[model samples]
Target: MKIDIVSVFPEYFDVLNLSLFGKAQAKGLIEVHAHNLRDWTHDVHHSVDDTPVGGGAGMVMKPAVWAECLDELLGLEPADATPDAAVDTATDTAAGKPVLIFPNPSAPLFTQRDATELSHADHLLFGCGRYEGYDARIPAYYRAQGVNVREYSIGDYVLNGGEVATSVMLEAITRLIPGFMGNPESIVEESYTGEGALLEHRQYTKPAQWRGLNVPDVLLSGDHGKVDRFRRDEALTRTNDIRPDLIEQLGCKALDKADRKTLMALGWEVSGEHPRRRGK
Candidate 1:
């Protein structure tokens, strides 16, 4: 997949060159490009923002620069296309038209589900807003022109800019693309992925016995069946304690007789009230 990120602090994206993403790029499994938002500016100051309309506390990004940049990137005619240009159904775009991405706290929370889904896109264009954010009309104008636009938020808290969130989201999205990782099965059991309804099981390394702490005995037993059972139990226990919300979302049916028994043993509330477990 190809992803283009437009941000005032393009340097913030330099970290994308590290580790797996770097390797993925080397292997041509994915492509990423960072563009400076200021390049669209025509004035000497290269200012991207001004006072927000309606008297806001923070500055709002200027619409003209955004429109010019996006128009050029999306293949809209520079002469005819402007932020205030009339919306139309024309589909012309540079190469594979990217699905536009805007991160906003007001938008739906981004999830592993969304990441997995976006990994399939042929191209993606991420708009990283600083200050107050991009002019509201930018996305609205694009959407009116038949562009596919999606908005997502990482969490409830706000940040100085969208670069960090975009970086995180890019990692999540890219790793899911086939061939991005050497081991195809590596992501199969990742938490929030398919069939991984519970939190990921705790991982361990060498030094079977460190100080007074010892690795789980089952892990050393080489008994694949027993090891699998142990891992499942740990995952279930962790999820039940740390994120019961995920368990609740899985609902009663997700807990079969074995899972219920494990939870019961862990002192979780799975007694007569949860009658469905009795038949499982």
Candidate 2:
């Protein structure tokens, strides 16, 4: 996979050269290029932001600068056009188009499912916004050119800029790419993955008893069947207590009789495939 990141602080991504990412690059599994957004500026100051057209507290990034950078990177001609309603944002990456992403605090939260989908892309271009944010028209104009543009927020809170959010998303998406991880299976049963999408159960290593806290007896047992059952139940219990929203999202087909019984014991009402908190 090829990844292009546009940020004012291109040095922030130098760390990508260390650890597993560095290893991936060494093996030729992926390629990364971080470009300074200011490189696209033509002025002496190389300014990339300006005061909002309407009164605003912070400066908004300039669209012209962003457009020039993106147009060159995405291999497109500059055109004045409205976003096409027929443009499919979900087009398959195999179609040989690069996926364009922007990090925005107000956008929908990025998810593991999104990472899985983007991992298959042949090329990805990420624009990291600073100050208030890039002009909204930047993404709109790219979409009009039939580019697969996406905007996402890593979490509910705000950040000073998109650099950190882009890093977080890049890590998530790149790690899922084939040959990126030493053990690919390590990602399969993780939280927010797979059909059930439940939080992962707690894990313990050797020396089962640590600091007077003993590992679960089931895990220590040699019986794999019992161990699997124990982990599944723990996952269900943890997800219910910590994030009941995940329980509510669970489909009936995903839960078996034993799972239903466990949820019922925890004051959850099972209606069809969905589970609800009691008295809610």
Candidate 3:
């Protein structure tokens, strides 16, 4: 995959050169490039922002700088032309296509599911607005040109720019790539992969016994089948106790006959009380 980031703070992307991302690049699985938006600015000060047209609280990024940077890097005209439109017209389509995204606090929340979807892209491009925000017209411009433009949010909190959010998104998606992890099974067995629930119970290496605790016997029984069953059972119990909402979301799937009986024994009911459990 190829990822191009246009940002005022291009230096912040040095984080990609050190870890798993670096390894991916070295292995020729991916290529990441960060371009300074100011490099495309024509002014003496290399200015990329201007006073808001409507008199906003902070400066807004100019469309000119973004257009020039993206156009030059993507080999397209900077005059409101969409990346996709440009690619379709060109003969060289070796690098499939790219996605245009800008992270903002007002956008829909980002999640692991989003990462999973983005991992399939041939290339991804980002425009990071650092001052107040980008000129709103760019999003509409891309949309009119048939580009898949989107706004993403990391969480409820705000950041100075989309740089950190890009890092978060990149790491999450890269980890999902095949052969990226030391143990592939770790991805499936992990929490929120299959069951959409938190991780199953865990018992770690020890002296068999800790300060005042002991590893569950099932874990040490040396029976693979029993160990798997024990882990699933514990996961059910833990999730039900601490995050019942998740169990509620799972509905009937959250409980089998044996688990339902067990819940009944613990004063739970499908209809009697515990309104949360009643409908499920």
Candidate 4:
């Protein structure tokens, strides 16, 4: 996959040159490039931001600068472009399209599910916004021209810019690419990959006993069936104690006879909203 990022501080992307991302790029599993947003400016200072047009506290990234950068890099002609529109023919494509992503605090929360989908895209273009954000017209204009564009947030809190968020997202997506991981089964067994979409169960290494504590007896029993059940139970217990919200999201769909029994033992209703179990 081809990944392109446009940011005011391209050097911020050096993080991509480390660890898995670096190895992936070197092995030709993915391509990553970071461009300076200021390169599209014509001014002597090459500024990319300007005071808000109306009344606003922070400056907004200029659409003109972004327009040039995007049009030149992705070869997108604005919906309103004239016959003489400045279009880059070398990098442009009719069938080759890119998904445009803008990271914002108000956007839909990014999840492993999103990472799974993005890992398959042919091209991904990220616009790392700063200050207040890019001009609202940037995404609107791209969508009007038939481009696939989306805004996503890593979480509810705020960040200085989308640069760090981009790195976080890139890592999640790139690591999912086929053959990227040494053990593919690790992906399937991860916390949110399947039925147990909750926190992982406690893990134990060699020297089963430490101090006065010991590994769960079931784990050392050599019975795969019992071991799996014990792990699932532990996973459910941890989720209930820590993030019941995830269980709530899963709803009744994630429950079966065994799971319902576990919850009942913990003083939770099998299918009711109230904590106290309703007499079934």
Best by lDDT: 2
- The whole-model C-alpha lDDT of candidate 2 against the native structure comes to 0.89
Error of 4 at 72 (Å): 1.6
The lDDT per prediction is 0.80, 0.89, 0.74, 0.81
**Where is model 4 more than 4 Å wrong at Cα?**
81-96, 211-213, 251-254, 271-280
Model 2, which residues run further than 4 Å from truth? none
Q: For candidate 1, give the lDDT of residue 149.
A: 76
TM-score of each prediction: 0.86, 0.96, 0.80, 0.86
Global fold similarity of model 4 (TM-score): 0.86
Worst 10 residues of 3 by lDDT: 86-95
Q: How close is candidate 3 to the true structure, as a TM-score?
A: 0.80
1-280, model 4: which lDDT tens digit per residue? Answer: 8999999999999988988788889999999999999888999999888899888799999998999999887796655833333234223432367878899888999988788777777788999999988898887777666666778999989999999999889888888999777777877766766544877888898788999899888899999988888887888788788977666665665577777788778667756542343453
lDDT of 2 at 268: 89
The per-prediction CA RMSD against the true structure, in angstroms, equals: 4.8, 1.3, 5.0, 5.3
Question: Which stretches of candidate 1 lie above 4 Å from their native place?
Answer: 78-97, 251-255, 265-280
